[model samples]
Target: MRFSLIMVAGIALAACSPPVPDSGQGVGFGNYEEYQKQQRARDAQLAGSALPPATAVSQETLAADGTVVASNDGSDLAAETQAALGQGQSGSGAATAAGGTGPQPEAVYSSGISQENNFDAVGAQRSIESDAAKIAQNRAQYKVIEAEALPARPGGDGPNIVDYALATTHPMGTQVYRRIGVNLDGKAARNCAKYASPDQAQSAFLSKGGPQRDRMGLDPDGDGYACGWDPGPFRKAVGG
Candidate 1:
């Protein structure tokens, strides 16, 4: 009876106790160890595929005297650039030699006139003395032309009208000669129409009994003019 009671108490105590938790089935951070293992694998893969480190550029340094210390790596590049420049210059020279010649200098011309703004320079070239000398030279070349006598009239029995015009001093319309006829104005108009000009009429009138005698009745009022012939212009020309 005592042994059976002890066995029953042990079974009851076991049934009432809380269950033991599974290592893989906890509420928080139960798979933290597995996560750590996965993280380590990814890190290993990225490390294996990483790029190589970049090369460092060579830098120039300044000396204590403030002079630049150029890098040795740049010396070869500078030498190659200078060699290319020298080749280009030589090629240009060869092309110029193949052509006939290079550009020529511009031609300059000299002028008699001065280009300076100095008034004294211009005054020295042209003065009152120079102008007087030029005037004297022109005067020495000048010649006075004496008035020549008029040519004699052609041989004709008729009186010269020019002489009559120069001789007359009285104004026109002053009765100079006696006129007696019927319709003398009408006769004069008809006779004057026979001549081409007043001068020609006067010449014909004087040729045939004009001023003193009315043969053709050309001088109607007998002012010694025929067909309104004017002597004023002829007198003015000679200052009579």
Candidate 2:
């Protein structure tokens, strides 16, 4: 019984020893040390195999209300920025908002100018031209001084048909003679009833008006003639 017990103990001890190597055709697998080396290689392969969680860096951004936030990655970045900043423009039109269009305000204009120039519209050249044209046109029309001739009235001692008192003695028998620039002639003078030499008549009329036959004894050298009338004053001066 003691020898049988010794053999069983020896068998149990061999069974408890480290596992043996595996030998296939020519290769051999060793014990725990080889297993440890294989474990280390497997750890390295796992480290290389698992892709490192994709590394990324994020930039910080500011919000409209001054708070910090992540930046947006969308395509409409500029539009978003404008909206957040409240910087968009509004008006009747784009041109009007930019101050580029529309009717201009009125400006004050004046007529008088100080400088001298040939083309000045408000100057003397225009006035002279207008006057010259008016005068030229007037000369072209038939404007005359004496329009027509008048006949002399017969005067004589034959019944003295023309009354000295009743007849109005205005020259040419018309008050139109008072107006200036008229062409007076001898025919107009013969219409007067009483005969006074032209000078005496004119002088007497200028002094007091009408016949002054009695006053100056104007009929001095007259043979029933008046106003120094052998030769009248004007004719005597001219020796006519």
Candidate 3:
């Protein structure tokens, strides 16, 4: 009976006193390091890779029909001029030889530029070629009077000098030379109304202009020229 009473007392003591557990709960992962390398392998791979290739650009050109065209080859002014003049060569379909029954070409007016004309452009170039002294001389005289002034010879007793323009193809490379000269009249027949000759006064009035004539008062409306003189050259040398 005593044993049974003791067992019941122990059971009531155990039920009243609950046991303590471990009491630790999982709060997930702890805080990691503040900074960590993530893409090192990817960065190294990209750094080792080669770069992309460069692109090549081309030049621009034109067609005969006035169209803007682009090309990768070459372009020049001669081609453009030919395109402008509509003188481009025949395409693969057409025959290009003379008398080949192609469309009749238009009559092109070509002038015969004489050897003198050619020499005019070419000679000016050749004359300045090798001699540095000649170049310096030309530089010194460049628009200055290359020759001395000429006047009415010994007694000044002659008709007024006139401009004698000459055209020659028959002379054929004679190297003709010309220059402007004066016709000073030492003997004055009158006061202010003096001239080398009547012809000089007329040509001066016509070419040197009316204002210039007015300055000299040579042509007085049909009154008469050779009435006055400036005692100077008929024309002023420009930039000299």
Per-candidate TM-score against the hidden true structure: 0.51, 0.19, 0.14
C-alpha lDDT score of every prediction, in listed order: 0.83, 0.47, 0.47
- Candidate 3 TM-score versus the reference: 0.14
Worst 10 contiguous positions by lDDT, candidate 3: 164-173
lDDT of 1 by residue, 142-220 (tens): 9999999988867866888888998788888888899987999998889889989999988888888867877888888
Q: How close is candidate 2 to the true structure, as a TM-score?
A: 0.19
Best-to-worst TM-score order: 1, 2, 3
Q: Could you give candidate 2's per-residue lDDT for residues 1-240 as a string of tens digits? A: 999999999999999999775654225445667777898999999988886456754455667699877665543556677765564343345657478776468998866655564356556456878989998998899667875544555763232212331233232222222222222233233322354444444344324322422233322222222332222333434343
Better of 1 and 2 by lDDT: 1
Clashing pairs in 1: none
Q: Which stretches of candidate 1 lie over 4 Å from their true place?
A: 1-118
The lowest-lDDT stretch of 10 consecutive residues in candidate 1 is 55-64
